[model samples]
Target: MTGFEDEIRRRLLSAQDTGRIEGLLFHSTAEPIVGRLHGDGLDVLWTARDPWVSAQYIPNAGSEILLARPDDWRLKDRVAPTKHDVLYALACEMSGKECCDVEWDWDGRAKSWRVPDGWPTYGDVVGHIEDHYGYVANSNGVYYVRESAGVVMPADWQIEGQVFVALDDGLHFKDVRRSGEPDLTEREYYDGYAFEQAMAQGYDGVIINDHCQADDYGNVPHLSFGLNAIGREKVEWLALPAVRRHLDPWYSGEAILTPDLDEWLADFEMEAVHAL
Candidate 1:
């Protein structure tokens, strides 16, 4: 019935069949919450996937709506409830809901229902802005994708024709950015944890993942070094690119694989080569 609720009703409810409506709840919370609703049991949930999402929830009346990880106690934050009927009606009129059956008048009453009964019918308002912060491999270095997207502002790095893709939080890559290309400020890129790990292992830049083997998910193959990871904080300056020490079809495909870093980096070489 309010301005924000009216806007949310126009956006999210129709996205039910689209699988994970991007902005379904949690506008002013610490993190961005997104979710979907089930019409069967009227079950619903919302969450923050950035900054390392975990299964969690908490209970309180801070807001009329509850946001949390599905089937978990780790709640993100309390969000105000929206008029689901308003959004639902808009959704049905615009895009048919194939995900679940919805009833604008589920209670059999004309929006005159009281609390507890009407509470279950309300939806939560999610914001359109999203924050993406993480480490993605660049050739010899990494691209720290630490930026947020909103209606008024454009994202700094994205997956279009741009070099940086909005990969998830826990993903890795071979050096996607090359050295001497341009932009070497820490604010643009963070000093990779992979380089730091190699230094922590007394190898210091000797064990970078320029030509390292990786899984289809962009994760380092058999890699447990826990290096080159990213946090929520933005990179203060661009970091130096990592050293190449392997051979493959990836960016630093001409480097050699080290015995210490790539004991089996050679095994995945055939697969990488076969692709080319």
Candidate 2:
């Protein structure tokens, strides 16, 4: 047995019970929790809740490990798993199988696994890092309770359709050194589709999530707009360097959408609220 596998066995055996084991898996951000002996390598999966996480990693050949997503995709260049990713990892471990490899057979329902067998285990490495943890909401109406536990909600948060949280992504931030609030320019960083769509739907207010200066991507500063209604918006915006830092972190919240809001928007008031 390799040191990694030996470590996982030691911890699993030391745990008080399966429940504690589950807790360890649920709360960790960069360690492997689930394991399996596979053909190519020893597969290990991680699901941690924290500043950032890999959620899954496999010790590939030559002392290198391949990182994976909770849904079993080989994740690349990402910092952490969202709440959903952590939950998925927990659920997989509970099944006594690797999350990414097996197609779960639960009461005839079709649920996918998040981790598969084929890499080295690193659960021990993640448990040692308590600086950050991921918090995933498990139920409807559970979000309110979770807020107290570090589940952050945006200011212009709109709970929409009892299924998802919607926001205008219009919270513009003035650079602390700036003399005044910046204005929207054609070349500035903004989600034109979100702005135009909000106007078309006649929403009472369009919330701006981020309006700040960024320099990681050369000199052309950019603005970021998040329209949480359509999930596609997030998928696209996650690529922006500024948005990746400021906005993507909040995408980890529970499925919530709030409407009938009266905050952070004035010019767009006296407008109708419609779902596009």
**Model 1 worst lDDT window (10 residues):** 51-60
For model 2, the superposed segments whose C-alpha errors exceed 4 Å read 1-86, 94-181, 189-210, 213-276
TM-score of structure candidate 2? 0.16
Instruction: Give one digit per residue, the lDDT tens place, for model 2 in 1-276.
Output: 344333433433343233132211211111122332111111111121111111111111112112232232322212122233433333333334443434545554335434444321333212211112332223331212112123322222322211111221332222211223344443322344544455456432233322332212222222222222332222111000000112232354511111111121221232324322
Give per-model TM-scores.
0.16, 0.16
| C-alpha local distance difference test of each model | 0.25, 0.25
